[model samples]
Target: MIKSTDIIRCCASPHGIFWLTVAVLAIPNVALCFTERMGIMASVTNIVLPVAAVWLLMALGRRPGKTALLLFPLMFLAAFQIVLLYLFGHSIIAVDMFLNLVTTNVGEAMELLDNLLPAIVIVVVIYVPVIVLAVVSLRRGDVLSRSFLLRQRRRSLAALVAGAACMAGSYLAGRDYSARLHLYPLNVFYNIYLAADRYKATADYPQTSAGFSFNAVPTHAASGREVYVLVIGETARACSFGLYGYGRNTTPMLQRTGGLTVFSDAITQSNTTHKSVPMLLSAASAEDYGRIYREKGIITAFREAGFHTTFISNQRPNHSFIDIFGKEADDWKFIKEETERSDMYDEDMLRMVNDILDKKRAKELIVLHTYGSHFNYRERYRRSEAVFRPDNASEAKVSNRRQLLNAYDNSIRSTDRFLSLLIRQLDRSGAVSAMLYTSDHGENIFDDGRRLFLHASPIPSYYELHVPLLIWMSPSYRQMYAAEAAAVGSNSRKSVATSASVFHTMLSLAGISTPLRADSLSVASSSYKPGERHYLNDHNLPVAIKKILRGDEDFVMFRKMNLKY
Candidate 1:
């Protein structure tokens, strides 16, 4: 009566069913984990990926009912992600930095481990739903049979062994590669996948020194202007300017100016904000800035010139750049209001600057950093009462890209309006006023490809890397610095000047004697100088390949056509 075949089949069936249930439950829990951390939603359309992946695995010799049944949800999530990319991928870029993860490395991770019990407590708070799902699955008894377990035991053990091998192989990788494992998401793989990418980029992107002393530093010691205010704008690309030949009239007020020296070809030292802002404010080129920034930065040069230094910003402060300058500055101010309130705009920052200018000395070095055109583009724009564009426009007209650019341009336009206000106020104050404006880096909208979004994702395109460098001198400063101003044409012919030159330029304009970087400093005493002020490379060049990485297919299009820079 003990029919062995029938009994075996029934048991195997229950085991398979239960195993599949647990697997299904596990995926959503993990996916929810990622989603909670990241905030992505799911839909039926998203299901195809997991299904296909299951089938593909089956085809690659897994089980049809079991393999797919287990892998389906995650497959769906990843698939949906790819599909979403296919649909709206036009404006997303993924990026990571080695310095960020590596600098404090083991110390931080160890501290996290030191707090492991607390972290586990936090995980418990988050894992409630997963626990519920597991409990629900447990209520339903064995869904797999003995035979099925016997069959899968060998495959499962082999898979576990292979996975262990991969994990060990990755962890055993180099420390630099290993450091990245401490980062979010990428750490799940223990930095195995992203480590290679970091290595390749680091090796390819060796830093260069800033010409702070006799070379790249530009000297500007004229007395016509009582004060010069260099407003270093952040992440603004030059080509988007109507003044710079963009069809969009993005810089209407700026272009109307008679005295502004807008360099059409200036570029940032790097595409990412981390790389660019520090270089602009310090004496290091893209090549060497990272190393030297850990040392004394541009503020020392500015301060030595007898100018009071004040850094005001809304962006998150990082260790190796303009942010560090603030910590080193005589006065450093940051407002949480910028990050918290949606209604709070750059104008609020201007008001703060105005207030500071109102109460104290009239001619201090006030640096204002704006979070212009940063991501979540929708959030950046002021709430519109109504549509600015007519109904005839589709995405090409009212596209998210254009909308973000509009928000950024509107902010710039506001900056222009404010500058006009400040100039009038400064003129009344009897102090020279000159404003130098530049961005940390430019943004990459849907311009380049489906692969990346924002500035500094890959090698970084000039669009995202190149920024706007606008200089407005008060009448007095202009008159005093006349010879310096007259040296460059109203239409100043360009040089391949990077942030390394900016350090010297800032000093030269202020008539400061201190060097930012001995190698990158240059004086623009006369504007006709055409030379490589300071260039950048991701890495040391092999003798066989002296090729420059500046004009890759992605960056070449941005070089000639006028950008906001």
Candidate 2:
């Protein structure tokens, strides 16, 4: 048997260090084979091309130390890839994922990282040593032997030729394969470029949309008193709500509440909050997301229609379109900015709503953006709301799924209570009123064999896209608009895209007439029609759900729920 000392010496050698660096760099590429869906040729080329490129660089450089150091940037990419793989299970680094790094606040980041200890540990163990080795090798002036370098260079050239051939073969065989799209570092770099481009566009939004208008007008008499509230929930999955046939009584209050219509088959166009929320608030859909940069949101439409629009949000501003659109309201306040407290709950937003209602404007439109059922789920609700016991999961691990789910269910219960109370307040207002509630997107809670556990993955799972959409109309409003109320109930089981439907439906419910509104997309309209669903991809392009959804499991789930994919 070889001694431990012998193994150490071999590892300490320049060749060993060079190979180690290549292997470490190849981790993400190798991982893509298992995590991503690709055919045999595409998978083989993905691994071979990237590895060959690394080998070529090392051999061509002659000095293994400097070459490894030159490739050090990839170490960071590898760490990011591994962590994402641990969290999402598939797909390359997306533009939104990159943007989220900048937009995610310290509190939110810590909450996510707190549960990602295992993945973080794995990243640290795999990368830290290789990084140290690269530094040490560089300082020691380590060089590859001339003979070894020549051999490696020849092998790398052959591998590159084979890889190129396989890539071409994959395309010829009708598979979609490209090095920049399928390969690791190349795809990651392209996404970085995309993220930067999007950031620049976001910075320029004010100027781009400065002169845009909804040209809105009221269909009802301007003298009539109206109160409409749009509640945008965060990370609330329909599968966890009692109103949507969940096993638990998470939404007991909502279930019992009269005149409430639950859109059981609602799905979001985008999974990330920044994209999804903007879509919900604006006329922008997966088919026309680019229009967001050149148009104002639904708040502006309401304001133009002679309603006193107010935006009250429990979430902290992330300097995205959400902030821009919220600020467009006649009156707006971000609760977190005023409170400066981490434990601020959704109920705080209710107080703001009460304050606005007290003003008793002739026509009012209030948007409540609640911090609903986000991670650290237990904190979303009060202790009294924790009807589901043993919900104190310290870490976000699959092993602690029961506790995590319990906490999530409790938060949903709290939401149920919050909505019920809001409805009661509306009933008491004695104005022609309606409330529309839907989430920006749903959450994944280690739900299945895939083990996905969050929103905003590059590719969304069934849970992440499926959300709960509810509408509550006051008795007076329902009696006044009987046809609209009946239409809402009729469309309850329809395949609805909240991003498109919410904007049109809200206007319909409020009796607003805007040229931008489409009757077919409005759930409240008698002309409502359920169309083919689409997803807003990373590049801001609309892709049919059937074309984008990959896994058989996701298709099965969509079919099982009778939802169009």
Candidate 3:
């Protein structure tokens, strides 16, 4: 056997050093591809990128400093693999995930670190050796003779040609596999470049109002003081709610409560709050996101309709949507100051509501944004309030699935209680009030055979899209607008509904009409049609949840049941 020192000396040779540098830069990409179960051809396609980059860089100029620069990207590539392997249970990092990370704020980052500290530690431990080896190899350099340089250049040129051929062949042979290479860390540099451009674009985006008013008219004559309360819930799935046929009585208060209409088929606009909330509030489909962002939302429309608008949030302040529309509210209050810690509860928002509605104005539009049932579900409600016991799996980071389910159910119970309290307050106030409650999106708890465990997966599933939607109209309010109330109750059981319908429904509930409103699709419209259930995201492609849930054939069959209106 060769001695360790001899092996080191041999690898320190000019040719050995050059090849070692190439291996160091390329191994991370190769390892990631292999771990991801990429086919040989697909692996070759990914391996070619960084290898070609290093070969080209070295072939053009064999400088130590220049070659050392390649290590930075290699380190990033390795780090990405390690972190992804732990967090997502795979080593594939997509463009959207990268963008989410790039745009994440400091507070969000801290929260992430708190949850993922173990994963971070594992990443550091695993990549430290590779980093040290790269550094050591960079420090030791051997100058090649003229003839050797020429020979190496010829070989590298040949290798470059072969790599290019492999890439083309992989694409031709396995298009889908090759396409997925965009998720590999070999594209990290490109993704970072794109992210920087996106950051600048978002920053340069105008903070001022979209200015154009819909100037909608109320179809019905005004009655007593109109109190429309819009509750934006967070991460509560429909399937888990008792009101939506959940096995557990997670919504006891809602079940017993009168004048509360639950829409069975209510789905979210998107899986993410950042996308769903903004799009829904603005009456913007994913197709026309930019245009809607440039224009005012329903808050502005209510304001234009001469309603006293108040935005009370238990969520973090200065969110993108909150910044735009919430700012436009006549009275805006956020009870939860710090997002990292859970100090304020959803019940605290009720206090803010009491303060705002102490004396009601002519027409009051109160938007309550709650941090209901977000991740770490047990923390969302007090331990004493937990109806489902042995709920330590999520808190202890164990895989006791029953415990996880229990914790989730407990959070829903808390939400039910909070909603009950709000309803009681509204009833006691004796104002003509109506409250609309719908989550920003749903959560996944390994329900399907796929074993998906979170919201925001690249793959679309019914669990992440279906959410609980309910409207509570006080006796006084229902009596004031009997026809409108009947219309809302009639459409509550519609087989298909989406968060996009919220805008038009809100307008209808408020008796405010705008040319922009699609009354046919509104739940509060007598001519209610489910329409096509298309889920939107930041991605260009519109996800048809209807098709995903009830296959293409069934979706077609179901749509036939509803009239086009």
Q: Which candidate is the best by TM-score?
A: 2
Q: Which parts of model 2 have CA positions greater than 4 angstroms off?
A: 3-5, 60-63, 145-147
Runs off by more than 4 Å, candidate 3: 1-44, 54-70, 89-99, 102-108, 136-159, 170-201, 204-210, 218-222, 338-342, 395-400, 546-565
Better of 1 and 2 by lDDT: 2
Clashes of each: 70, 1, 0
How much lDDT does each candidate structure score?
A: 0.49, 0.88, 0.69
Scored by Cα lDDT, where does model 3 land?
Answer: 0.69
Q: Is candidate 1 or candidate 3 better by lDDT?
A: 3
Native-referenced Cα lDDT, model 2: 0.88
Q: What TM-score, to 2 decimals, does candidate 1 have?
A: 0.61
TM-score of 3: 0.83
The Cα error of candidate 2 at residue 313, in Å, is 1.4
Q: What TM-score, computed on C-alpha atoms, does each candidate reach? A: 0.61, 0.96, 0.83
Which 10-residue window of candidate 1 scores lowest in summed lDDT? 539-548
Top-lDDT structure, candidate number? 2
Expressed as tens digits, the lDDT of each residue in 236-328 for candidate 1 is 677766656776666666677656777666766666565566666666565564454234566655665555677777655544345555665
Sort by TM-score, top down from the best: 2, 3, 1
Off by over 4 Å in 1: 1-226, 316-322, 337-341, 356-363, 376-409, 448-452, 487-491, 515-556, 559-565
Candidate 3: RMSD to truth? 4.8
